[model samples]
Target: MNQEALTFRAATAADIDAIVALAESAYRGDSGRRGWTTESDLLGGRRTGPDEIEDFLCKPRSMVLLGELGDPPALVACAHIAAHDEVGYLGLFTVDPTLQGAGIGKRVLEEAERIVRDDWRLSTIEMTVINVREELIQYYLRRGFRRTGKFLPFPYGDARFGLPKRDDLSFEVLEKTL
Candidate 1:
């Protein structure tokens, strides 16, 4: 694949399935094992599905961006942006596990931020990450996000979210000004 030719654009309603598949491949079980971002040890069960992703696609002032490459442009990654007070909420940021470290994620995020700031006219982008994910947190930190120490309990009953392997699982808020 000509990696340099990869591009980005807003994902449509029809893209929900591809988006879910990409998220799971990047974070779920044995398939995710092919990449460095696997959360299999920390959780189990489905990572995400059409219903959830479709909801994001249906909202106004909201959109899911899909990174593309190749002829048909496989949905290699996705991110959700929603309107918040004076900022934008960025979540569900995902990239194909096997494709990480190739700078595709960085481009997708930068494009998403551009959509949030320039199109939506927001000043900041906020997201939450598993608090114990030191490596993941560091990745965001390197991208200019700061820890706010704010947190919320992991939804234990939601198999869709992931099954916890340990106690003390929660998410911490992180933000970066655009």
Candidate 2:
């Protein structure tokens, strides 16, 4: 896969299925374990479902981004960005397992920040990472995000959010000033 040929764009309702598959393969059950980004060991169930994705697509000020490649254009990666009052929220980020570490995610993150700063005209971008995902948090830290230490309870009993493998799971906020 030649990343140089990859293209980036905002996702549409038509992309929901591909985006769902990409996200699941990157974060969910055994299938996700094929990649370094798998959260399967920490959680069970689907990372996201069709309904939730459709909702994001319909939400105001929200955009789902996809990194695509090939003539038919397969979705190799995806992320969600939403405008807040004075900040941008980034979430649902994932790269195709095989494509991990190929600089694709870095480019996606950079483009995400660019969209926040330029498209949304926001000064700060915020995200929440699983508190125990130190490696993931560090990845963002390298990209200039700082840990806020503020934690939000993971949505328990919400199948839409996934089933936690442990009771202590929570999300820690991370923010970057654009």
Candidate 3:
């Protein structure tokens, strides 16, 4: 993949469906299996929906950043960043399943950190990963995020998050100072 061809921008309401689709393709169902980020083996149901994306887009100090590529521009990656006091919260990150391991995710993350440090003027950024996702956590660790050892219970009963494949699901907080 041509890393230089990728561009970043704040997603609008019009892009909600595309973002949802991208996330689902990258994290759930058979398509997600193409990438190392797939949570299909651990969970089921939709990864995200329009309501969730719209909520993020409407929130103050929050934005859904998108990464696009190609001539007509395709929505290949996305993440949700929101200001929480002096820190920035990052979530809903995903890249096209077929395009994973091509350095797109790293670029998107770097851009998110830049937005937190320069645009939001926040010194720190944090994210949560499924506690069992050691590989994913290591990926973040290599990118400067540290394990905060703060665990948050996964919303098991809530289908909005996902339908857990097992009962031992939880999230671990990770942080980085920009």
Q: Ten consecutive residues with minimal summed lDDT in candidate 1? A: 1-10
lDDT of 1 by residue, 66-162 (tens): 8888887777778888887788898888888878888988988899889988998998889989888899899999998999889989999887788
| Residue-level lDDT tens digits of model 2 in 1-178 | 8898889999999989988999998998777778888999888888998898998899988989899988888899999999978899999999999889999999898999999999889999999999999999999999999998799999999988888889989999999999
Q: Which lDDT value does model 3 have at 48?
A: 94
> Mind giving the per-residue lDDT tens digits that candidate 3 earns over 1-178?
5778999999998999999999999999999999999999999998999999999999999999999998889999999999999999999999998999999999999998999999889999999999999999999999999999899999989999999999999999999999
| Residue 39 in candidate 2, Cα distance off native in Å | 0.9
TM-score (C-alpha, index-matched) for candidate 3:
0.98
Ranking by lDDT: 3, 2, 1
lDDT of 2 at 131: 93
What local distance difference test score does each model get? 0.86, 0.91, 0.94
- Highest TM-score scorer: 3
Clash counts for all predictions: 0, 0, 0
- Pairs in steric clash, model 2: none
lDDT of prediction 3: 0.94
